[model samples]
Target: MLAFKVTTVGASSGFILTKEAMAKLNVKKGDTVFLTDAPGGGFRLTPYNPDFERQMALAEDVMRADRDILRALAK
Candidate 1:
Protein backbone atom coordinates (compact mmCIF):
# COMPACT_ATOMS: atom_id res chain seq x y z
CA MET A 1 0.00 0.00 0.00
CA LEU A 2 1.10 3.55 -0.66
CA ALA A 3 1.56 5.91 2.24
CA PHE A 4 0.68 9.58 2.43
CA LYS A 5 1.26 12.24 5.05
CA VAL A 6 -1.26 14.86 6.09
CA THR A 7 -0.07 18.43 5.85
CA THR A 8 -1.56 21.82 6.53
CA VAL A 9 -3.25 23.61 3.66
CA GLY A 10 -3.82 27.11 5.00
CA ALA A 11 -6.09 26.31 7.99
CA SER A 12 -7.19 22.95 6.58
CA SER A 13 -5.34 19.63 6.51
CA GLY A 14 -4.67 17.79 3.23
CA PHE A 15 -2.45 15.14 1.78
CA ILE A 16 -0.03 15.76 -1.05
CA LEU A 17 0.20 13.10 -3.71
CA THR A 18 3.59 11.89 -4.74
CA LYS A 19 4.66 11.85 -8.38
CA GLU A 20 4.30 8.07 -8.49
CA ALA A 21 0.82 8.22 -6.95
CA MET A 22 -0.22 10.92 -9.41
CA ALA A 23 0.98 8.87 -12.35
CA LYS A 24 -0.66 5.72 -11.06
CA LEU A 25 -3.94 7.55 -10.61
CA ASN A 26 -3.53 9.21 -14.05
CA VAL A 27 -4.30 12.57 -12.51
CA LYS A 28 -2.65 15.96 -12.86
CA LYS A 29 -2.92 19.23 -11.04
CA GLY A 30 -6.47 20.69 -11.02
CA ASP A 31 -7.95 17.31 -11.87
CA THR A 32 -10.75 16.05 -9.65
CA VAL A 33 -10.56 12.87 -7.63
CA PHE A 34 -13.14 11.20 -5.45
CA LEU A 35 -12.82 9.62 -2.03
CA THR A 36 -15.47 6.91 -1.73
CA ASP A 37 -16.41 4.37 0.87
CA ALA A 38 -14.75 1.01 0.50
CA PRO A 39 -15.91 -2.45 1.42
CA GLY A 40 -15.16 -3.68 4.96
CA GLY A 41 -13.63 -0.34 6.03
CA GLY A 42 -11.54 2.65 5.02
CA PHE A 43 -11.95 4.79 1.89
CA ARG A 44 -11.05 4.50 -1.76
CA LEU A 45 -9.50 7.22 -3.89
CA THR A 46 -10.51 7.06 -7.52
CA PRO A 47 -10.61 9.25 -10.60
CA TYR A 48 -13.98 7.82 -11.67
CA ASN A 49 -17.32 9.09 -10.43
CA PRO A 50 -19.31 6.36 -8.67
CA ASP A 51 -22.59 8.17 -9.21
CA PHE A 52 -22.00 8.23 -12.95
CA GLU A 53 -21.50 4.49 -12.92
CA ARG A 54 -24.83 3.99 -11.16
CA GLN A 55 -26.55 6.34 -13.61
CA MET A 56 -25.07 4.47 -16.57
CA ALA A 57 -26.23 1.18 -15.11
CA LEU A 58 -29.76 2.56 -14.84
CA ALA A 59 -29.54 3.86 -18.41
CA GLU A 60 -28.40 0.46 -19.66
CA ASP A 61 -31.33 -1.21 -17.89
CA VAL A 62 -33.76 1.17 -19.53
CA MET A 63 -32.14 0.66 -22.91
CA ARG A 64 -32.39 -3.09 -22.56
CA ALA A 65 -36.02 -2.90 -21.51
CA ASP A 66 -36.83 -0.63 -24.46
CA ARG A 67 -34.61 -2.23 -27.05
CA ASP A 68 -37.40 -2.62 -29.59
CA ILE A 69 -38.46 1.02 -29.33
CA LEU A 70 -34.84 2.16 -29.60
CA ARG A 71 -34.22 -0.02 -32.66
CA ALA A 72 -37.29 1.41 -34.35
CA LEU A 73 -36.20 4.98 -33.59
CA ALA A 74 -32.71 4.28 -34.92
CA LYS A 75 -34.06 3.65 -38.42
Candidate 2:
Protein backbone atom coordinates (compact mmCIF):
# COMPACT_ATOMS: atom_id res chain seq x y z
CA MET A 1 0.00 0.00 0.00
CA LEU A 2 1.06 3.59 -0.65
CA ALA A 3 0.70 6.53 1.67
CA PHE A 4 0.37 10.21 0.86
CA LYS A 5 0.59 13.32 2.97
CA VAL A 6 -2.27 15.76 3.19
CA THR A 7 -0.89 19.25 2.77
CA THR A 8 -2.47 22.67 3.00
CA VAL A 9 -3.17 24.46 -0.27
CA GLY A 10 -3.69 28.05 0.79
CA ALA A 11 -7.35 27.82 1.80
CA SER A 12 -7.91 24.25 0.65
CA SER A 13 -6.18 20.88 1.24
CA GLY A 14 -4.49 18.42 -1.06
CA PHE A 15 -1.97 15.60 -1.26
CA ILE A 16 1.40 15.24 -2.91
CA LEU A 17 1.94 12.61 -5.54
CA THR A 18 5.53 11.49 -5.65
CA LYS A 19 7.34 10.85 -8.91
CA GLU A 20 6.95 7.10 -8.37
CA ALA A 21 3.23 7.39 -7.78
CA MET A 22 2.85 9.63 -10.80
CA ALA A 23 4.72 7.09 -12.89
CA LYS A 24 2.49 4.30 -11.68
CA LEU A 25 -0.60 6.28 -12.60
CA ASN A 26 0.91 7.25 -15.99
CA VAL A 27 0.05 10.90 -15.43
CA LYS A 28 1.85 14.19 -15.03
CA LYS A 29 1.15 17.70 -13.89
CA GLY A 30 -2.20 19.18 -15.03
CA ASP A 31 -3.80 15.74 -14.90
CA THR A 32 -6.87 15.01 -12.83
CA VAL A 33 -7.59 12.41 -10.13
CA PHE A 34 -10.88 11.30 -8.66
CA LEU A 35 -11.30 10.90 -4.91
CA THR A 36 -14.17 9.17 -3.15
CA ASP A 37 -15.06 7.35 0.02
CA ALA A 38 -13.51 3.95 0.55
CA PRO A 39 -15.45 0.86 1.59
CA GLY A 40 -14.56 0.93 5.26
CA GLY A 41 -14.27 4.63 6.11
CA GLY A 42 -11.18 6.13 4.53
CA PHE A 43 -10.97 7.66 1.04
CA ARG A 44 -9.80 6.43 -2.33
CA LEU A 45 -8.13 7.99 -5.34
CA THR A 46 -8.96 6.87 -8.86
CA PRO A 47 -8.21 7.81 -12.41
CA TYR A 48 -11.79 6.95 -13.26
CA ASN A 49 -14.86 6.99 -11.03
CA PRO A 50 -16.52 3.67 -10.23
CA ASP A 51 -19.95 5.21 -10.84
CA PHE A 52 -19.05 6.10 -14.42
CA GLU A 53 -17.70 2.62 -14.96
CA ARG A 54 -20.91 1.12 -13.65
CA GLN A 55 -22.94 3.18 -16.09
CA MET A 56 -20.66 2.17 -18.97
CA ALA A 57 -21.03 -1.49 -17.99
CA LEU A 58 -24.82 -1.15 -18.07
CA ALA A 59 -24.64 0.38 -21.54
CA GLU A 60 -22.46 -2.46 -22.73
CA ASP A 61 -24.94 -4.98 -21.36
CA VAL A 62 -27.82 -3.33 -23.20
CA MET A 63 -25.85 -3.38 -26.47
CA ARG A 64 -24.85 -6.99 -26.00
CA ALA A 65 -28.46 -7.97 -25.33
CA ASP A 66 -29.44 -6.51 -28.71
CA ARG A 67 -26.50 -7.93 -30.64
CA ASP A 68 -28.65 -10.09 -32.88
CA ILE A 69 -30.97 -7.19 -33.70
CA LEU A 70 -27.98 -4.99 -34.48
CA ARG A 71 -26.39 -7.61 -36.75
CA ALA A 72 -29.58 -8.07 -38.73
CA LEU A 73 -29.98 -4.33 -39.24
CA ALA A 74 -26.30 -3.97 -40.23
CA LYS A 75 -26.73 -6.48 -43.09
Highest TM-score: which candidate?
1
Pairs that collide in candidate 1 are none
TM-score of each: 0.84, 0.72
Q: Tell me the lDDT of model 1 at 56.
A: 100
In candidate 2, residue 37 scores what lDDT? 96
Tens-digit lDDT track for model 2 on 1-75?
678889999999988899989888777899878888999999877777688899999999988999999889999
The best candidate by lDDT is 1
TM-score of 1: 0.84
List candidate 1 segments past 4 Å from native. none
lDDT of 2: 0.87
**1-75, model 1: which lDDT tens digit per residue?**
789999999999999999999999999999999999999998999999999999999999999999999999999
